[model samples]
Target chain A: MRSINAADITEAVANLFKQANYNLGADVLAALKKARKTEESPAGRDALDAILENTRIPAKENIPLCQDCGTAVVFLEVGQAVLIVKGDVSKAVNDGVQQAYKEGYLRKSMVIHPFSTRTNTGDNTPAVIHTTIVPGNKVKITVLPKGGGAENMAKLGMLLPVAGRQGVIDFVVKAVEQAWSNPCPPVIVGVGIGGTAEKAMEMAKHALIRKVGQPSPDKENAALEKDILHKVNNLGIGPMGYGGRITAFAVHVETFPAHITALPVAVNLQCHSARHRETVI
Target chain B: MIKGIILPLTEKDIKSLKTGDNVLLSGTLYVARDAAHRKMIDALDRGEPLPFDIKGQTIYYMGPSPAPPGKVIGAAGPTTSVRMDAYTPKLLAKGLKGMIGKGVRSPEVKDAVKKYKAVYFAAVGGAGALISKTIIKSKVVAYPDLGPEAVLRLEVKDFPATVINDIFGGDLYIEGKKKYSLAQ
Candidate 1:
């Protein structure tokens, strides 16, 4: 068995938080550049320019890309052959997040409660961590700082098996139309098809980490993504929802087999900031 | 090319602004979002005086990152505006004239803008670092317990924003989309 020190994981996660907040990822940057070119409205084009310029300023000056530094969402793929030594895995992740938010000067956006009290957790700890045991020895960690504006707009629905592909497209298009400029336009639409309700939602979020405009390996899913993309852009949401031809930069669909009776789908919308960073240790 | 106006401005100065007009703001503004708005509205309900006067002042719906040493603020950009929509009309009733944030507002907010002769401005969402450059100073003014959601009194200069909803009910998002939308 390959033994990985828990301290190493903690250090890696901490560094990931700091780096991700300071640097805008290449995939997201490329998508923004493409959106700038395709956006039709003058106001939409101007918004895109500001977003690009913001990324540059943050990287050059070592500041965060957005004031809502977002909740630290850690996705971990731990290989079955590896054993974590020295400490508790979950606590280690939280420790790293705490250190990063404090040291990196990012905002602490997490609250202790949702409806009541609404107390702040000062250090931005207790990250939303998801871990999966996979085949390899290396552990892959991806940090996605999900802002509230986009997170609040996420949707999930369970359709009867008979609803088919058109149902999926309709649900996604409707969700984007309803959200309009609320999630901040020129958004990325992540669609999760099949699976159970919760799994579908997770899949939709996971799909967002894929490179922009990259299609699913499955031919059917790729076609679905393309159709949904066309429908969403046609909604006239445009950049910042100010109206334009480029409402969505890309629509990424990920799918899995489900029970014969279920056709669950989930849509997780991400604003243009789309802050995500990954590391393999 | 549209001319940009200097900041530390008044309602009278911004009233002439229209949707899609580019404006460069210079001078001081405050930063407040959901938590701060709730508290401020509560105080108003209690008939207690606000920590900062609402007259001729611009409040940005932002909760900025802690500043690095030698910097005024970190990634100080606008947050989504709709979250504070419920509290905005009340604030506007008190002579709150200008607001800076992202996203669209409710019809009530648009109506309030026209009723109160206030202006709703849109800053580039996600352009925190670029926006922070314009803020010359920042300090917590109220609701410090809310952490990053605290109300901050900021001094800004030459900040860039667009008039999204003007006093005449001109909605930039609606109008802009209508102009560019293709019939499906």
Candidate 2:
């Protein structure tokens, strides 16, 4: 069995959070550059220019890309042959998040008793962790910091099995229309098809980690992604709703088999600040 | 080409502004978001004075990240304006003249803008770092317990924004969408 120290995991996660927030992903930057040329509205083009320029300041100044550094979301893929040494994975992950938010000066966005007192957690901790046991010996860790504006706009629909593809397209397009500029526009639409309700929601969020313009391997799913992107851009939400053709950078769809009679679909909209990073150890 | 605007926007200034006009706003504005808005409303309900005078003042719907060493403030940009809708009309009634934020506002907010002779401005969302460059000064004014959500007094120089709603019932989001929307 391959043994991995929990300290290493903690360090990796902390660095990932810092790097993800400071540096806008190259793919997202490229998409924005492309959008700047294609956006028809004068206001829309100006917004894109500001957004593209914003990408540079954070990296050069060693500051976060956005004020809303977001909730720490850690995804873990642990191989069956690997054994964690010295500490539990959950504690390590939380420690990493705390260290990163505190030392890196990222915003502490998490709050406890969310419905009631709504107290700030002081340090962004108790990361929302999703773990899966995989086949290899190495552990793959991915940090995805989800901002509240876009996350609050996430929607789920448990459609009738017969609702079919058109139903999904309509549902997703309508959701984006309703969300409008609230999700910050020029968003990445993540669609999770099939699976149970929660599973679909999780999958929807997971789909956002894919690089901009990357399509799903499944032919039908990829086609749906393309079609959804077209319909969404046609809504003319544009960059921050200044209004033009580029409402979304990409639409990513992930699917799994569902129980008969269950056609669960979830849409997780990602803001223009698509911050995420991954590491394998 | 952008118009330059000074803060403490007057009735004449509000009347001159229209939706879709890009402006470089300079001078003083207070920053507050969800938590601070709630507290301010509660203070109003108690017949208590707000920490800052509301008359002819503009409130920026933003919550800044903690500044790193040598910076006046961290990434300072506008938050979603709709979240402040619940408390806005009440604030507007108290003589608040302008608001800077991103995204669309509710019908009630638009109506309040017209009724109060106020204006709503939209900043580029997600451009926090760039926006921070415009903020020359910042300090917490109230509710220090709210951390990032605390109310802050800020001085800005040519902070970029677009007029989204105006005193004459103009709405940029509606006009922009109508201009580009292809669907019937």
Candidate 3:
């Protein structure tokens, strides 16, 4: 068995968090440039310009792209044949996040006893970690720092099985419309269809980790993604809700098989700052 | 070119502003977010004076990261304003004149703006790093233990924002959407 040190995982997690916070993904940056070219509303274009400039300032200043560094969401794909030596995986991951947030000057946004005390957790841990075992020996770690503004706008619909395609589209469009400027348009819409309710929500968030504007490889999901994107933009929430033609940078739909009785749909929106990074070891 | 407005906005300043007007603000603003707002309201509930005079002052609903060396402030941007909806009217009642934040406000906030003759401006969300450049100075004024959520006294110059709600009952979010929404 290939044994990997847990300390290395911790280091990778720390680096990923810092990198994700300090830099905007290249795909997201490219998409914003393209949106600026086509955005008809002057306000929308101006908003895009500010957003594009925001992308640059972080890299130069070594500051986070936004004040809300977000909750550290770590996705781990561990190879079944590999062994993690020297320490516990969860603690290692959390240590990395703690180190990065403290040393990198990233905001520690996580809170504990959320309902009662609403207390700040100080170091932005423990990270929301999801782990899966894969066939290969390499471990893949992806950090998606989810900001609260967009995350609070997530919605789920338990549609009737007969609701089908149009129903799914309508639900998503309405969710985005209701969200309006809150999620920080032009946003990236992540749609999860089928599966159980929680699974659908998880899939919706996972869909956001995809490259900006990249369509699903599945033919039907790809078409559905396009349709949802068109309808959401039609809502005219526009860039930062200034009202324009380009509301969403992209719509990503991820699906899983579900029980015959249920047609679950979940929508998770990502702000234009869309920050995520991945590393394989 | 965008119009530049000085802070400690007077009645004349509030009256002149309209929804969708893009303007650059140069002046001092007190920065506060969720925790600070709560503390302010609690202090008022106890009949104690606020940390600072609220008269004609603009508050920025912002959260900031720790400043790196050679920087006065780190990436500072507007947080979601609606989260502070519960405490806004109280502060408005106490003479708060303006607010800078992102996202839509509740109807109560709109009514409070009209009643109080205050204005609401939206700085581009997620543009924190760019926004930080305008923050020439920052100092924590109260609730220091709240970390980044602490209330800060800030001096800003040429801070870019768009009027989202104005004293004349004009709402840019509503008006802008109506103008561009295809279904309508």
Instruction: Find the candidate with the highest DockQ and give its number.
Output: 2
RMSD in angstroms, candidate 1?
1.5
Alpha-carbon DockQ of candidate 2: 0.80
- Residue-level lDDT of model 2, residues A26-79, one tens digit each, is 898899899888889998999999988899899678578899999899999999
Candidate 3: residue A207 Cα off by (Å): 0.2
Write model 3 residue lDDT over B1-184, tens digit each, in one string: 5889999898998999999999999999999997899999999999999999999999999989999999999899899999899999999999999999999999999999999899999999999999999999999999888887889999999999999999889988888788888862
Error of 2 at A150 (Å): 0.6
Interface RMSD of 3: 1.2
Write the residue-wise lDDT of candidate 2 on B1-184 in tens digits: 6899888787778889999999999999999998899999999999999989999999999988889999999998799998899999999999999999988999999999999899999999899999999999999889999889999999999999999999889988888887888872
Predicted chain B of candidate 1, TM-score versus the true chain B: 0.95
Expressed as tens digits, the lDDT of each residue in A1-281 for candidate 3 is: 89999999999999999999988888998999999999988899999999998888886787899999999998999999899999999999999999999989999887788887767889999899989899989999999999999999999999999999999999999999999999889899999999999999999999999999998999999999998888888887799999998999999999999999999999999999899999999
Off by over 4 Å in 3: none
Compute the TM-score of each model's chain A versus the native chain A and list the values. 0.98, 0.99, 0.99
Model 3 fnat? Answer: 0.76
| Candidate 1 lDDT over residue span B14-111, tens digit each | 67888888888877788889889999999999989988988878899998888888888888878889999999999999989889998889999999
Off by over 4 Å in 1: B6-11
Local distance difference test, each candidate: 0.86, 0.92, 0.93
